[model samples]
Target: MSATTPNGAPASQPKKTPQIPKGKTELKILMLHGYTQSGPLFSSKTKALSKLLTKALSPAPYNLHPTLIFPTAPHRLRPSDIPGYTPSDGAEGAEAEEDDESDNWAWFRKDEATGTYLGFEAGMRAVATAIADAGGVDGVCGFSQGGAVAALVASALEKPHREPAPSPSPETDTSWLPLLRAANNDAPLKFCVVYSGFYAPPPTLGWLYAPPIATPTLHFLGSLDTVVEESRSQGLVDRCVDPTVVVHPGGHYVPVAKDWVLVLAGWLRKRYDEPAGTAKKEEGNL
Candidate 1:
């Protein structure tokens, strides 16, 4: 049976917890999509990378199978809401936007004036719900806006038992912490990977950065990419206790090539304490 919302409506893309095999652990990764992208789209885009990761981790002392769950954000985005979307002079283009409305989604909308994320709590709730449905996840990965949310999720999971400050306001809404804990059964993520991610600068989000994120983080930056500048990505890297960074030649998208996929596999090996060269050896056989 599918999980439902408090109002009894079916939840968005409820994921089934993958069964763990004998002598092997189930490695669940929550894959969050970027602004304007949906879970299915992200899953399709990262298909190659996902396959490679699974193969890399399947062998020997590292008997791990990765099961990635891509969840669509709760907020729907209209054509006009997209960053580069311009009014169509042609009727066909306008009709296309209206017809394809369901593909566009966002975790939260940015309030340019206050530099805060509007509907941020709803976004967190959506993620927590996904976690609950899946029993829990071992890690998270995201791109662009979703990447920012990935960092927030990792930070929140680190110390979910923490209480809010004496006087809380809209800016500092830590209310989602407990809910997140309950959803994930109080499991802290083993690692997180962010592609084209940025830091939330609003004063309301200071609590997330003040203590800095301790979870192992891997950040990928595109040297020639202009969608999200390097400086912005650096801000996120700076906040991490000790983050691993990989600068790809591409821009604004997750790299799924063999080499890049191996880099990710290597990182995961390090995180899980698996011996090095396991992924490379397995790749050569493939």
Candidate 2:
């Protein structure tokens, strides 16, 4: 259950890939599921993709052993008196009812007007801790609400530190930058992959200005995604500097196209395989 890097160093090993060969870095991906679903469900859907990536790149030139860390969404009650609590997918509806009965599990609830199930600040802190526990994350990937959260984390990590208040001049306002810098002091994220995610404005973020996230991001969208309109997703991508976009001809679900997975896998490999100093140099040029 342990992975090794190209230099024969041990990497984060998941149970699935028990006996990985030496000189291959174990690629640990933290996967956050979309709204109305849990981590296990997300893991199930991506099992094939994970296996394919693992098999395709086992040694040397493409040495990457991928592991998925699926975190459960915190629980919260469904909004009372909401007429259309039932999901379009029958299976999802049943699962929601089951959760309601158990009084646990939800990504977010509009009934209480809470933006996210665990509250934005608390949720980000939890995610940060999880990444740290994973020996520092290689990359962050998510779907829908999870995607939005991932983007938020990426943005927070790249924000530069600002000076304290009480400056002599009124033109010097460095309060917000300081807060963001503190939040992201530990590790800088390498890249991000977001599926069916939207970029909400600063007002929507409770007046918290989003810091520039220089991480190379890949955004995937379904042409017919009703839940998250293409325009909204594109807008989010537009805000990011030099983000890559992949469009699928399907709906809200992750594109089943094998090529997309391959591309993503390649991106991760390139980021992780390169020396840290080299990666930083390349990022600086960008």
The candidate that wins on lDDT is: 1
Best-fitting candidate, scored by TM-score: 1
**lDDT of candidate model 1 versus the reference:** 0.81
Clashes within 3 Å, all models in order: 1, 7
TM-score of 2: 0.70
TM-scores for candidates 1 onward, in order: 0.86, 0.70
lDDT of each: 0.81, 0.62
Q: Write the per-residue lDDT of candidate 2 for residues 1-286, one digit (tens) a residue.
A: 3343332222323434245568877766778777666666787888877777787667678777776777655534453323256455456666656544442233344334534233444445446545655655667788987887777666656534212325454643333333433434555567889999887542445222234456778888888888887777876787676677777788888764578777666666667678754543443222
Candidate 1, superposed: residue stretches over 4 Å from native: 1-10, 13-22, 89-100, 160-163, 166-173, 274-286
Error of 1 at 247 (Å): 0.4
Q: Flag regions of model 2 displaced more than 4 Å.
A: 1-20, 77-107, 110-118, 159-185, 202-211, 272-286
For residues 46-67, what per-residue lDDT tens digits would candidate 1 score against the true structure?
Answer: 9999999989988877899898
